[model samples]
Target chain A: MRDFRHDHSALALNTATLGHNVEGAGAGWSPERVIDACAERGIGGIVFWRRELAGRAAAIGDHARRSGVEVIGLCRTPFLVGPLAERDATAIADDFRRAIDLAAEVGAPVLTIVTGGVAAGTKGMGESLKIVAERVAQAVPWAREAGVKLALEPLHPVYGGNRSCLVTTREALDLCDGIDDEALGVAIDIYHVWWDGDLSRQISRAGRRILGFHLCDWLAETTDVLLDRGMMGDGVADIRAIRAAVEAAGYQSFCEVEIFSANTWWKRDPADVLDVMVERFRTVC
Target chain B: MRDFRHDHSALALNTATLGHNVEGAGAGWSPERVIDACAERGIGGIVFWRRELAGRAAAIGDHARRSGVEVIGLCRTPFLVGPLAERDATAIADDFRRAIDLAAEVGAPVLTIVTGGVAAGTKGMGESLKIVAERVAQAVPWAREAGVKLALEPLHPVYGGNRSCLVTTREALDLCDGIDDEALGVAIDIYHVWWDGDLSRQISRAGRRILGFHLCDWLAETTDVLLDRGMMGDGVADIRAIRAAVEAAGYQSFCEVEIFSANTWWKRDPADVLDVMVERFRTVC
Candidate 1:
C-alpha cells in the first residue's frame, strides 16, 4: 500500500467538504475556486459531484490541466428507482451522461454511483433494490465507454430509505456482479461502512474493485445524519484500523476526505480546514 | 405473528419511549409510576433500565407486584472494555448484580448488557471487540444464577467508542456464542439494528435467541443519537417489515416500544405519548 505518512500528494478533497468554507463566501465558491484552493495547499486531487459543476464544467477541466491537480473522481450519479415521468428519467440519464463526459475531460479516474433511495411513499426494500439493479445495468455500458468506472457507494442504513438504497459493500458488489461490468465497482467510505458487522469480510471482498476510498469520522452521538460529520480525530471511528483493513484487501487508492458538517467544519476558514485535515491525515488517518 | 391491531396488551412499553412523556413540569413521575401507568393501561410488560429503577429499587418490586406489571426485561448493564480500576470493575459488577437481583424481584425475564466503548485512548477494532467479549463473559454466570437471561444489545456504530463496543447484531451474537450460555442472547432493538444492511440475515440467525424486541422509528433526519427517536410511523423505519422478518424467524415476543426523543416526544404529555404510541403501534408495527 502507498504510504500516506510521507505527504498528502495522493490526498483528494471532496469539494463538498469546503463548499461552505470562508473561501467560498458568496453563494459558496465555484468548483474552479475549489480546485484552486486545493492547488494552493499542495493538495493532490479533487473528488466532486458533477451536478455541482454545472456551468463551470470546462473551466474546472481547464484549470486542473493547467494546475496539475488530478481530479480523483466525480462524487456521484445514479438512477433512483421510482415511478417518475419518462421525461424525468430521460433528463436524469442525460445528466448522468454529461457527468461522465465531464469526468473524462478532467482526467478523473472514476464516476461515483450511489443508487438512489426507496421510491417515494414506499417501504419495500426488495422492490427498491430491483429498480436500482435495472437502472444500473442500463448505465454500465455507457460508463465503460466514457472510460470512467462507476463507483457504487452504499450509504449508511440511517439513509436506507430516503438517501440511498445501496447500503452495503457486499450489496454494491452484488450489483457489480449482476451487471458483469469491469467498469462498475464500489467507493468504500469508512464513515458509512465502519459500523457494518461484515465490514472486514466485505473489505476483503471489495479487493481491487474498491474504486474510491472516502474518510470521515462518525460522532459517538451523531446529531444529524446529513450534516454532523466530525473531523478525522474528533469522533470515535477507528479510521486507521479500517484503513489498514482496506489496504490489506488490496485497495491502493487515494484517501479522499468527505466531511459534511454544516455546523462545524463548514463555518471554518478553508485554509484552516485543509491544515487540520492534513495534520490529522498524517497523525490519525 | 400476534395481532397488535386489537390492543397493545401484547406489547411492552420500554420506558425510554415513554421517557419523552415522563419529563417536564407535570411529568416528574418516577419509574415506579411509569410501571403503574403501564399496568393501568393494561400494557403487557415493561423492559426497563436499572438506572430508571435505581432510586426506587427499595419499593419497585412491591409496586410492580401489586400493580401486576410484568418486568419483561431489565434494559442494560455492561462496562464496555474501559480500563476500569479494580474498584471500578468491582463497583460495575456489584451494580449489575444488584440490577439482576432487582430484575429477579420484579420477574423480569432478562437483564440487558451494554459493554462500555473502547478504552480511553485505544484505537483498534479487534481490541475493542475483545474487551467487550471479556467483560460480558465475566458477567454471564451471575446473570444466569439470578434467573435473568443476559441479553446483549449491540449499539449502532455511532456509539462504537464510548457507549458500547458491540456494534452489530452479528458481533453481539458472536459474543453470545463465545459465552455459550443459555442465559445469554441478544436484545434486538430496531433503532440500533434497523440500519444494518445484513439485518434480515442476522435477525434470522438470532431466531429464538432474541430475548427482547425494542421498536422506534429512525427519523430520516435524526438530531441526536441518545434521543430524537420518532414514533413508530413518524419516521422512516420499515417497522412492519422488520417485525414481520423477526416473527418469521420464530421470535414470538412483545414488540417493546423504546423511543428516546427528548426534544419532541419528551415534551408531550404522558397520556398523549401513550395514546400516539398505541395508534402508531396498531398501524406501524
Candidate 2:
C-alpha cells in the first residue's frame, strides 16, 4: 500500500465535509472558494454535490482542472428507489439520465449512485432492488455515451428505510455484475462498510470495479444516524487497514474525505476542517 | 407458516418489550406478575432479562412452570468481547460460566448471547471476533455440561462498536460452525437483519442450528440506533416472510417479540402493549 505519511497527493475533499450538501449547514463556501482551498492545500482532487452544481457544472469542472485539481467525482444522483425515489417510472429514468448528464457536464470521472430507500409500499429490499437494477440498466446507455462511470454506494443498514436500500458491498457488486456494464461500479464508503466483517473478501472481489473510496469514522456512540459522522481519526474505524484493503484491491485513486459531522466539524471553520483533514490523511488514514 | 391468526400458542415475550431489561424503564412488574400475564393471555413462553434474575432464577423458573408458561429463554449473557467485556481473562470465563449456570437454574431452553462491542486496543472486528471464538470455545464444556444452549445474536451493524461486534447472521453461523458444538446456535432477531439482501440464503443455511426466532419491525424513520425499535405490524419489516424462512429452516420454536421501543411502546400500558402484540400477530405478522 502507498504510504500517506508525508504528502496528500492522494487526498481529496468531498464537499459534504464542508457542509455544502445539507441546507443551512456549512459556511456557504462557494464552489470557487472550495476549489481554491483545495488547490491551496495541494489536495489532488475535489467532489461536488448536485446542490452546488445547479447550472454551473461545466464552469466548476473547468475551474478545478485549471487549478490543477481533478474533479474526480460528483456527490450523487437522486435516489432511485424507496419512498424518496421519484414516483413515476418516466420521471425516475429522466432524473437518472439528467444526473449522468450532470456528471458529464461537470467533467467528473464518476457519478455516485445512492440507491434510495425501499420503494413505496414495499416490505423488504427485493422488489426495490429489482427496481434499482432495472433503472440503472435503463440509464446505462446514457452513462456509456457520456463517458461518466456510475458508482453505486451501498449505505449502512440504518439508512435502509429512508435513504438507500443498498446496504453491503457484496450486494452492490452483485447488482453491478447483473448489469454487466462497464459504466456501472461501486463507491466504497468506510462509514457504511466499516463494520462489515466480510469487507476484506468483498474488497478483493471488487478489484478494478472499485471506482471510488470514501473516508470517515463511525463514532462508538453515534447520537444521530444521518448526520453525526466522525472525522477520520476521531472514531473506532480501522482506517489504515481498510485503506490497505482498498489499495490492495487496485483502487489507486483519491482517498476522498466525506464526513457529515453536523454538530462538530460542521460547526468549525472550513479552513480548520481542511487542515485537519490533510493532517489526518497523512498521519492516521 | 403456522396459522398465527388462530392463536398465539407459538408466541413468546422477550421482556425487553415490556421494558424490563433497562433500568428504570419497565412498569416495576414482578417476574410472577409478568409470567401470570403471559399465561393468562395464552402466551406460551417468556424470556427474562438477566437484570430481573438477580437471585431468583430458580424461583422464577418454578413460578413460570407452575403457571404453565415455559421459561423459553434468558435475555443475554454479559458481553464476552469489546469495551464492556470483563477485562481479566479468567474473570470473563468465570462470568460466562456463571451465566450458563444461571440459564440452567432458570430452566430456560436457551441463553441468548449479544456479543459486546469491539475489544480494547483493536481496530475492526477481526481481533475481537478471534477473542470471541476462543472464549466461546473455552465455555463449550460448561454450556454442554449444564445442558444450557448458547444462542449468539448478531446485532445490527449500527451496534457493532458499542453493543456487539457480531453484525451478520452469516457471521454468527460461521462462528457457530467454528465452535462446532451442539450446545451453541444462533438467535435471529428481525430488527437487526431485516435489511440484509442475502437473509433468505443465510436462513436456508442456518437450518436446525437456528435456536431462536425473534420478532420486531424496523420503523421507516427510526430516530435512535439502540432504542426506537418498532413493534410488529407497526414498522416496515416483512415479518411474516422472515418467520416463514425461519420456520422452513426447521426452527419450530417461539416467535419471540423482542422490541426496545424507547419512546413509543414502553410508554404505553403493559396490558395494552400485550393486546396490540396479539392483534398484530393475528393480523399483519
Candidate 3:
C-alpha cells in the first residue's frame, strides 16, 4: 500500500467534486482558478469535465502543465446509448470522436466513458451493453491514434437505468475483452463498486487493464443515490483496502477524488473542499 | 409466462406495496382489512411485515386461509449481521429463532432474510458476509424444525452499506451453498437483481433453491433509491422477462409485488393501490 500521508502529489481533483456541471450548485470556480488552486496546494493532477472545458482544453492543459500539475483525465463522453443519447448512430459516433479529440488536445492520458443507461425503446440492459461495445469498437482506432486511453466507468447499479447501464467491473472487463484493444480499459470507482462481494476478485481480474482509479465514500444512509456521495473518511467505504487492491493490480497513477454531493460538499467553498480532500486523502483514503 | 391478465391467482400483494411499515407514510390498513380486500379482489396471496403482524400471526394466518388467500411469506427477520446487528451473536440467534417461530405460526412457508450491511469495526464485506453465514447456520435448525424456509433476499447494491451486505443473488445462493440446507434458499426480487448482467445465469443457478419471486419495477429517474420504487408497468424494468427467468428456473409460486413507494402509491387508498396492482400485474408483469 502506498502511503498517501506525506506525499500529496498523487492526489488528483475530479472537478465534479468542486461542483462543476451541477445546475446552480458549487462554488463556480473557473478552470484557470481551479488549476492555480490545485497547483498552490501541491495537488498532483486535475480531471476536468467537458462542460467546464468550454472550448479551452488546449489552454487549460498548457496552464496546468506550466503550474507543475498534470491533466490526469477527462470526465465523460456523452451518453453513447440511452434516453439522453443522440438518437442517430452517426451523431453518437461523431460526439465520441470529438471527445477523444478533446482529450488529445488537453494532453489527458485517459478519457472516462460513462456509457449511458437503457437505450430508448429497450427493455433490458443486454441490448444497451451490446450497443455500447459496438460504439466503443468503432471509436477504439481513433482513441489509439490520439495517444489517449478510453476508460469505461461502470457506475453504481442505481445509475443502471438512465446514467450508465455498465454497472459492474466484471462487465467492463468483459467489454474490454470483446473489444480486445489496448486503447480501452476500466476506471474503478469505490463509490460504484465497494458494495460488490466480488470486488476483490474483479479488481485482480482487471489487473493492467485498470486505467483509472476514483476515490469517494458511500454514506451508510445515502439520501440521494446520484448526488449524495460522501467525502473520504466521512462514510463507510473501505478506501485503503480498495486502494491496496488497485495498486496490487498494478494501477500506479493519480487517485482521482470524484464526489457528486448536491446537498453537502457542493455547498462549501471550493478551497475548503480541496483542503479537506487533501487531509482525507492523506489520513483516510 | 403465466397469463397474469386473466388469472390473478398467481398475483400476490406484499403489504409494503400498499404502504404498511414506512414511518408516517402509507394508509395504515390493518392486516385483517388487507386480507379481506385481497380476498375480495381474487388476489392469490399476501405477504406481511413483522411489524404489521402485531402478535396476531396465528389468527391472521387462519383468516387468510379462510378467505382463500395464502400467506405467501413474511417481510424480513432483523438483520443477522452488520453494523445494525446486535453485537452479541446469541441475541441475533435468538431473534432469528423468534422470527422463524412467527413465520411458522403464521403458516408462511418462507421468511425473507435481509442480512445487514457492513459490520461494526469492520472495513470490507468479506468479514461481514462470513458473520452472516455463521449466524444463519446457527439458526438453521430452528427454521427447519418450524418448517419455515429462510429466504435470503439480496437487496440492491445501494443498500450494501447499512441495509444489506448480501447485494447479489449469486452471493445469496453461495451462502445457501455453504449452509447446504434445503431449508435455506433465495428470494429473487426483480428490483434488486435486474441490474445484474449475470442475472439470468444466477437465476438458473438458484433453480429449486428459489423460495420466492418478488415483482417490482426500477424507475428510470428514481428520486429516492429506497422509497421511490415504481409500480409494475410504471417503470422500465422488463418484469415479464425476469418472471420468465424465475419461472424457467422452476419457481412455480406467486409473483409477490413488494414495493416501497413513499411518494406515490403509499399516498393512495389501499383499495386503489390493489386495483392498480391487479391491472398492471396483468398488463405489465
Best by lDDT: 3
TM-scores of all models? 0.90, 0.97, 0.96
Docking class of 2: medium
Model 2 chain B lDDT-worst window of ten:
B19-28
Report the error of model 2 at residue B78, Å: 0.8
Q: What is the DockQ score, from 0 to 1, of model 3?
A: 0.75
Query: What fraction of the true interface does each of the listed models get right, in terms of native contacts kept?
Result: 0.27, 0.73, 0.70
lDDT of each: 0.76, 0.89, 0.90
User: What residue pairs clash in candidate 3, if any at all?
Assistant: none
lDDT of 2 at B203: 94
Candidate 3 TM-score versus the reference? 0.96
Candidate 3 lDDT by residue in tens digits, B1-285: 577678889889999898787765555667899999999999999999888877789999999999999998997888887768788888888888888899998999999998998887777688889989998988888899999999999999999888898999989989999999999999999889889988989999999999999888998888888888988876767778888998899988898999899889888888989999899888888
- Per-residue CA lDDT of model 1 for A134-248, tens digit only, reads 7777777887898888888988866665667778888888878888778888898977887676777888988888888898887765667778888888876778878888899
Predictions ranked by TM-score, top down?
A: 2, 3, 1
What stretches of model 3 exceed 4 Å from their correct place?
Answer: A22-26, B22-27
Residue B130 in model 2: lDDT = 90
lDDT (10s digit) by residue, model 3, range A1-285: 888889989999999998887766555668989999999999999999887787889999999999999998987788999887888999989989999999999989999999998987777798899999999999999999999999999999999889999999999999999999999999999999988878889999999999899999998878888789999987878888899999999999899999999889998888999999999999998
Q: DockQ rank, highest first? A: 2, 3, 1
Worst 10-residue lDDT window for candidate 1 chain A reads A78-87
> Model 1's lDDT to the true fold?
0.76
